[model samples]
Target: MNTENDNDEKSMTTGKAQRGPLRGMNPIVTLGSAALTLAAMALAITLPEVSLAWLTSLREALSPILATYYVALVGFFLVFVVWLGMGRYKNVRLGPDDEPPEFATFPWIAMLFAAGTGVGLLFWSIAEPITHFGGNPFSEEAGTPSAAIKSLSLSFFHWGLNGWAIFSVVGLSLAYFSFRRGLPLTIRSALYPLMGDRINGPIGHAVDIFAVVATVFGIATTLGLGASQMNTGLDWLFGIGVTSTTQLVIIAVVTVIATGSVVTGVNRGVRRLSEFNLGLSMVLLLVFLVAGPTVVLCAMLVQATGDYLDSLLAMSFWTGVSTDYQWQFDWTVFYWGWWISWAPFVGMFIARVSKGRTIREFVFGVLLVPSLITFVWIALLGGTALYMELTGTGTILEAVREDVAVALYQTIGTLPMPSEAIALTGGVATLLIAVYFITSADSGTLVITTIMAHGDPEPPRLQRVLWGLGVGALTAVLLVAGGVQVLQDAVITAGLPFSAVMLAMVVGMVRALRDERFAPVPGQKHRLAKEIWTGRDEVS
Candidate 1:
């Protein structure tokens, strides 16, 4: 009796001790560090000779590795498409009580879109059309009908279905299984289907760590670009010099705003920011409609929509494996690798807010809605720039090659309400960029803490803050040395390791499902407990 009593006492004490490290930490550190890291990296880009060379070499060395990652992503997506379509696997859920989703469907989708794809969408909206108009990078004559149309179509193709598909499959699968199957609601659980027991071992730790690092740099790149451009907008509108100090100031300001939101917790900081960004986006879009060549832009959008539908598949999967190797390398492979690099963070984000959703529903929503919005954005804003460039209305191309931010400003200037338009556009751009980065960074910090602490949701604030500062310091160093482009290259490098990890996650998802369905053994306690809490299954 004494032995049993002592054992019970020891167990209780152990449990209390384990919980001690995770409670009551400051929130500011959790949020500020992420923003700071990105700023540092952006500043680093200013040292073109040293930082650029390092970034380039890092990217080049990782090429073969990234290519393999893309291939694996493609394979994973294809497998899910086949399995789900054929009804080989049923939808799974974790957690009981049918907890409400984190955000409304539209806003949730918008968050994912804005968070992962914002950089490309904004960058290419004006830049791509001009780049394509100059002719296929491989073809002769800048605007040859076949080549030009194909290039635009291909650009849409790259940003369209295939890009989103990779994220959609992994995210939706994980969400469904986690919510339905009583799995821990984290990325590691996504691998449960494949890794089984080993998922709790060294390999699993490595996968999750890779995901954390990838997410840090991936979001950092976006923040660096957006913050730098916001600085340019301030310069154009108010005569502020585009100095490193000014850029750092902008980074500091935005980081504080984001940190405040993050500390407020998810329901307040994250959701409110997402909603605010959406409203701001609408205003910016409205300005584009009212200020720009509304009629011509509309017509171009209609035309592009038609063309996009016609060529999406051919352009997306067009291995072009045989054609102009450089074209494939520069365009197709580059996009594939880019998307792969971004998958883990985006995938994790999707899983976070996507509780209480079905496999089919999550997949379709993530894949289709965001991609469609991107298609329209490019067709509208990018199409307008295309018209301006083609018709000699203004020199959008010269502006872009010279300076990308100026190119956007010049395009906005051509519209009717120039000042108001630029203000609205810049404001929205800054807010969206900042909010998304915050969402990515803080959420990432939170998620990383959870992973490191064995999937605890309310992780230690100290740990969260520590990770946040780490990200910020990394960003600061990179920015101080190289600048935003260098950060971009660093992101590409960071993504390489995570690509393989994401693939393992796919395999884990598959295995977990198979095990639950076929094995005679009872489910694990944690998994079963999650299901009961989330209301996925009835308590027997």
Candidate 2:
């Protein structure tokens, strides 16, 4: 199935052409999601402090129990993905058997990496590891050599393989149902096997509505967070004020740029920005690695990767009952919830770009490749900070503790470059953050608009502009009242229900995969390998 623009979308699914602003949209789901979004914005605007307090209290109360569920569920996702990718289901295509991928391999990966990580990797890469190193179950002591290694391992546990597996499951389920089974590419379509025709009625409507609402909130929260980071980056580099007004300005500027990208659709604007950010990210990472203790970072990567793999299961299953329970609620649980909430937005975007590929190739490319690259990034950047901290050569730990936003710029300043070169590198890092923010907003806009249009791959440009402004305004208003952080906590707490939705999706995907009429036999090892490698399964 070829992707379409909103103009083309009108005639493809509909028997006759339509016109006007709401053309090519599902009115009920669209209006319902819009209403909820507006209500959230009102809550932020009117009772900012009360909203903050309630959301905080709710998160603290629920995350303890929810963290355990998230842990168990995410661990299972990784295992399931591994089995599906390497076993009999390996050769199953996401679309028709003869269809080729929509985007080339490099561009495909670039977009995936951009949408999945974005400002997250930069915001957390150094800051998260240092915080864990300061104190965690794996590394209880503050600055011991052992503490440093295990601390990096904990970072890997959160940002590595398991997280990508979550995205893989969501995308696979949606892609399989929508492309192969001829269902609409929305949350409801993936549940067809379990829900049957009910998915076409209220049940389906509710599923799609909930996904749209959750995704809208999640995107707003991310934009708010990214705007905050950009505010800090400006102050760190050029001494621009880091006030709320500055953040509001940042959001406004980004929203405009993102709106343009969304209107242009994925291939032209989104693809180009993702590719640029990916390259700039690599360049910055290389500079950091070379400028600071190259041999030490490499050794740490090797050792920390080994440690991470060896204790993966123990860490994955740990609910912190025996260890630091509060830490579990604070860090790992928070990450899982955030990832689950984001699955709808990121998964749909990935599915749109990943139209034609085998389950095996998709799993390997989607789950493993980004994970490995992020692991290296975390190791080098965080590893460099840890080395300096342990050696007592840098004061970055002080900045990290006091203000995490400036920790990255602080790391850049401490690099062994001259003052002029240091300033140049810091500018580049700041530029990277802004680009990532743009890509994220653009991708999120595309995803939300697609859902609003009832899974039309290319949503109308008008719908995209509407959702894009809605999210930007929501973030800007919250930033004004200083409610962005509170709203983020609230939305992450809201992710609890979406976690259940994801579990249901897993069940539906399994049933669908098992129903595949012609899968290679597992006992025929040679045939299975050939089928997987050549993208042609042997029909029984």
lDDT by candidate, in order shown: 0.59, 0.81
Cα misplacement distance, residue 539 of candidate 1 (Å): 14
Model 2 spans with C-alpha error above 4 angstroms:
1-20, 481-484, 520-540
Candidate 1 residues 1-540, lDDT tens each? Answer: 665346333422221224345343212222333344455455564554766777687677755544445545564575565455336343433233345555678778767775557655665666666676775643567754444454456567778777777776656655655555544445565665455546545565566556666667765666666666767777766788777787777666656555555556556666666666666666667767766778876776666667877865445445444554445555566666667666766776677777765455566677777777776677666666666666677787778777776656667766656577567676666555556556656655555555454444565666766666555556556665677666656766666676666567666555445544422112322233323232433211
RMSD (CA, Å), each prediction: 6.5, 4.9
lDDT of 2 at 299: 95
Window of ten residues with lowest summed lDDT in model 1: 518-527
Compose the digit string of candidate 2's lDDT tens values, residues 1-540: 543334234323432115666788777777778887788779878988877777788877876787688899999999988998998888777776767788899999999999998888888889888888788876657778888899899999999888888888888888887776655677877886687657657766677778877777677777777887788888977888788889888999999998999899898999999999889999998898889899999999999999999999998888988765678977888788778778898888888888888888789999988988899999988998888889888888888888777768877877888999888888888899889989988999898878767777788888899888888998787666554556557567757777788889988888767666577332232212323321334210
Q: In terms of TM-score, how similar is model 1 to the real structure?
A: 0.80
Candidate 1 ranges with C-alpha deviation above 4 Å: 1-55, 61-72, 75-102, 137-140, 143-152, 319-331, 418-428, 514-540
What is model 1's C-alpha RMSD? 6.5
* Each model's backbone clash number: 43, 0
